[model samples]
Target: MNQDTTMHPRDLLRQMFLAAVEAAQPARGVPPYLPPAPKGRLVVVGAGKASAAMAQAVEKNWPGPLEGLVVTRYGYAVPCAHVEIVEAAHPLPDAAGLAAAERILERVSGLTADDTVLCLISGGGSALLPLPLPGVTLGDKQAVNRALLKSGATISEINCVRRHLSAIKGGRLAAACYPAKVLTLLISDVPGDNPCDIASGPTVADPTTCADALAIVRRYEIELPQSLREILESGRGESIKPEDPRLAACTTRIIATPRMALEAAAEVAAKAGVTPYILGDAIEGEARDVGKVMAGIALHVVQHGQPFATPCVLLSGGETSVTVRGNGRGGRNVEFLLSLGVVLDGAPRIHAMAGDTDGVDGLEEVAGALLAPDTLARAWAKGIKPMDALQNNDGHGFFGALNDAVITGPTLTNVNDFRAIVILDPARD
Candidate 1:
């Protein structure tokens, strides 16, 4: 094996991802924004991949007494002195999440004006706080969540459906603490960083209606339980209103976001002597489709030197969706890379990396995948068909065969996905 100089695109890409993850760490970012202790008791609650870490940070930093609970993905829990951490399912709702949501709602139901509630919101919160509405079962919400995850629904669309069905989401949690001052510090993972969309907006008002949820289910042709279908059709389960007096004392802040992560990555690229082109911080759509489009941009930069010249890196961040029609491992980042490889057709001097900032994409342990100039040729030689793999929603399998999966185990933070394309200039004459 020869060591090629070009900064080993994969290494450079990994550094960029690690940098973004570091920039959004809860221990470093969440503590400072924590509200001062109330005159009375302080209660903490939250949900996301970062919830446990955020809770731990609060526990470590607070000089006053604190007691509360938070839910996080399985295997991501951290120990805290005062707050209880509950591990639950992610990307899909489960019974454990239901229990946690119930507890969260119950915990904040009767708070005094002098007491304070510190709510931590981040990605994966929609599933982590799966409190089904009255007349709905946990099973119903779980089924809907599974379908939404496989339907290529945008984060907002999925969250809209979730908010309608949930008891604690869409400002209901904050609404529970009627007279209490609720202060929410958020780590944004969705595109656009809407407070309501982050973890289904447990602390903020959701202006989206049940009609929008119904439209999403219909667009994706998602089969919902009879009760869920009724809820959507009747438009009965409205989330808390923006002007709801119950939520008047709530204060929400987006402490971190994908845009912030992207800017940090851009700085890294600039330091490497690479002109960085930030396509957008909130690009959304199907993962593979986005990859094909990004490939076109990389080709333009390489051949035409337009938009951005070579020796440049293209950076983008956001949550992309994957419509799973097959049973292969599903990761939006891997799907994007495989699609890009096929589109580029082994174009030399161009490489790309795409991964979830949370360090897990879909159900796979690997965050995403990487593409070198010879990726397509290597797949062809191995009898792997990019189109077939993509059709089966098998980005992980495709990248796994080439040993190109970017595995960063449990990064403990979520800012959605980070994608980068490196277009190197052709060798000088």
Candidate 2:
């Protein structure tokens, strides 16, 4: 698609975000990395927000017969004739996920060395494949997940706990496959794209220990169910280790990542006659704090051109955390954008957009929101206090009132969060 010079800056920013998401689509990202057809039966299974779409991509590209099951977040499923698509809760586990996890484990249990088990994994897989260890109940896992999410812990910390509590995660699934050749295809949504951290490494070996999981829980002061505490304390729920013989035949490959998405957006910016500066694809921190830092960078670019000249777009991709201290709607992308708007404070010829690549930000349906030079002015006109909204973690509400929210219903793939700030030369316009 050609860049229309007449397109509004907000529209341009949104276009870049869309291009990033499109680049990470399972159909486009999965096929290139798919392993060759196995000698024996191909049994596919996976859990994540993108697993269903990944399954569909696999089926569309595979030449041989394939039958499998994949569980995705509710409403994230894409129709697949060969692989069964199961819908489940995400960022939280449900009975549906538990059942699906059990069935998936059963499906791969008796495979031989010649057989191939294709494991499709992505972000949100940890919560989507919550099969509690023998002593821990589903409720226990759910309680810990809620605590970890609210406690301001990073994704790695949260997944560390999930790895230990789960019966199927942290390479146990690969172990269950025994001598089968397990090929795990990942669409990384984590900051570092660590295969062991994605989807809690269901089909890959985990190097972390139950001790590490316990430490994270203690560091965050997350109260766990008594049964879960016992499991961790006794080391009963420790995940499969890196040197475990059971995982000897398993392999993992990342087909899509946050960096790839950012590169796509950078290309879009370049096509629009804007120099694209990719700051980093693995930036991580509190949403508001990261926004402030990004704003400083944008200002530096505008005033000094130390980093780069004007008529450029600054791009970054990573998962930022939101420590919810308010009752307002909380989405990390919107939080970052709102904080950015406040920092810019009506800076001329500057615009920005931040959104989750999955098309859902926090618990809201909206992907994220856009920010213009007049964003603060518009909010003031509407009698909405920007600081008050920011304090309340209500970026969604603030952006919604101004009708600036970017809504893209489920992109069917995830590569974490995407943010872009366009700095244009006022003289050029």
Candidate 3:
């Protein structure tokens, strides 16, 4: 049977996105993985957009006294009683994030073997916890972050560089706890769910070295300050290696992931009578190119029904990079949707939606936008030029003009980007 026969396509898409967000909620993901109460004290420390919420989850579940600190995006804070939540800028590290990172290191320091250090980590932690190594100014960190973000580098690559430069990340935080047992609870937003890549692996051993980080910076031709370059060149920026004894008591567990979020969205599709097909949950690449590839698959399904049958919903989740060109205000999700819209060319019976599950797509507070079959036609009718918008990287502007922008402010949890394509069955309809 055809889905959305009675339900609006946009509404179905929104419901599916919301379900995906709900699946990765810190409140739901944090409790089951909570470690036993320590004999001495339980100290909680975390960093990310969802870290405050994760701290809240810990506070609600822990039966004993606990005090800690976490830093989150400015608008994503969830108030807590014991654990202090600090708000900071994201996608770019601010002075507030620098201070919070310092305090987090101090919070875990001087712990005893009997104590347990509980760490909460998720996406955006790199920016939310920016503790530059000695001699590296916050301005330098901000400058590097700006360069890496615009360089079209993958999250893994960006984080590699971040870890090398950070004093609190790359296993340093866990090392600070020394003899204390450390249990790190992670909500994975990285492509591979590699614990080391999530939040730059503050509580786990790092496999990447300073050379590896330097190579990524060079690969993207990302300009680093001369003094910062010296840190990498001198090997002083090296992360805590896996063989380091300080991390012996560290244990990391992934509590949620992009795959889990996509599966949750798939359930929403299945319940709506639409067959759900999960495209690779770790799909990654340039946003426009990835959108082009997915569009080709969607068209094949619409025309031939070879891989998946009609009335199927294609679901995918992962992070995508954007190489800023013409300077139009847009995020990867919107850019992908815009490219998909262009490639689909208003193909009939196909509708799609793409959004960052965290409710922030790129620099905008808006999540993402929906793509209807008639989206282009609507744009043309309203005197909009799709190609011009694309050239200017103006998906947010284009979608906004069409009144199709998706907005879900501060979702409080992050699992990267979620995209869905709904193919209707004409026969069933």
Candidate 4:
């Protein structure tokens, strides 16, 4: 078949990435999974990059009186009539998140069996709901978060630690609504789409225990404050278990997942007259390492056409990590793209884009970066060494220098990361 060259390679690549993000949007995912209006009272509480939008979706469909509160990352708020939308820091907890967590717990307390709580959950919720347990201060929570993020601990590992030290997560939020039924709506950002892993499973039963959290913290060499360590050692940080009766009235529905987002991007590729191949939606690893593996795959496809043919797109969605050894600003997507660009070494017809679906990659406002055959050549001409950039973990700085950072400020949703490699054509003489 023939390659579709009507749209520029860079634009087509970005279009696919945006298509993935649009698929996991709260407006589209929240409506279908909304629970029916309850009998006694309907309470909504949530935390995430997408929580505000999810809350708005709930308000638009519910036909009864419902008052709620949801905290999202700063600037991610969506207005609602009854449900209060609060904004807070993300990827790290702040006093604002601490206050919001307290309010959410208080809001769900004293509910009878007739009352229903609609828990809106998504990625970023873990940090957005930072209610430290008695002996664990908010400062302790913030310190641990910083160490875990820099240590390159996986989201699941980091959340396991967070849950044990929190008074609200690990089914505690749902427990607070004792006798009241909770219908949780989640837009899963974790690999495997595990409800318990999403937002550290605030309203769901957690089979993991305090020992598990301690193990992860130790394995990652995360420096926890003495208070946090004592909580783990004393078992004071034990999470709500799976057989806990408080969770009997709770249920969850994952409205959107990385796989769904990737599928949507694949559909866009097909419509664009290109074959779309989804490698895996739940891939996990160091960002640069994953990029190198993808580069090997792409090389095989380009040179031998073994796994997939030319003129096709390889699509994937999942969260990759960065172990910060360099002084560069954070963003796993840019790191992955930079590594891919390095490995590809200016190969012909290989173009790719990687970005966080939520529009913020790491601590930076840039989503990610785009890479082309001439990326390295351009960087070298500008006296920027791609190798040095990679070593410094400065993917954002590197791409920014090349004027290639993809910025889609505040897409108001989170479904982890989206990556697409477009092998537009064969090598030319």
Clashing pairs in 1: none
Each prediction's RMSD over C-alphas, in Å, is 2.2, 1.8, 1.2, 1.2
Off by over 4 Å in 4: 1-4, 427-429
TM-score of 4: 0.98
Each model's lDDT: 0.87, 0.90, 0.91, 0.90
Answer with 3 or 4, whichever has the higher lDDT. 3
What TM-score, over all chains together, does every model reach? 0.96, 0.97, 0.98, 0.98
User: Which regions of candidate 3 fall more than 4 Å away from where they truly are?
Assistant: 1-5, 427-429
Least lDDT summed over 10 consecutive residues: which range in candidate 1? 1-10
lDDT of 3 by residue, 199-312 (tens): 888888889988999999999999988989999989998999989999889998899899999999989888888889988888889999999998999999888986988888
Query: How many clashes show up per model?
Result: 0, 0, 0, 0
lDDT (Cα, tens digit) per residue for candidate 1, span 286-362: 88889889989888877898887768889998888988888889789898888888899988878889999898988
Candidate 4's error at 54, in angstroms? 0.5
Error of 2 at 312 (Å): 0.6
Q: Between candidates 1 and 3, which one is better according to TM-score?
A: 3
Pairs of colliding residues, candidate 2:
none
Kindly list the per-residue Cα lDDT of model 2 for residues 66-109, writing each as its tens digit. 99999999999888988999999977799999999999999998
Q: Pick the candidate with the highest lDDT.
A: 3
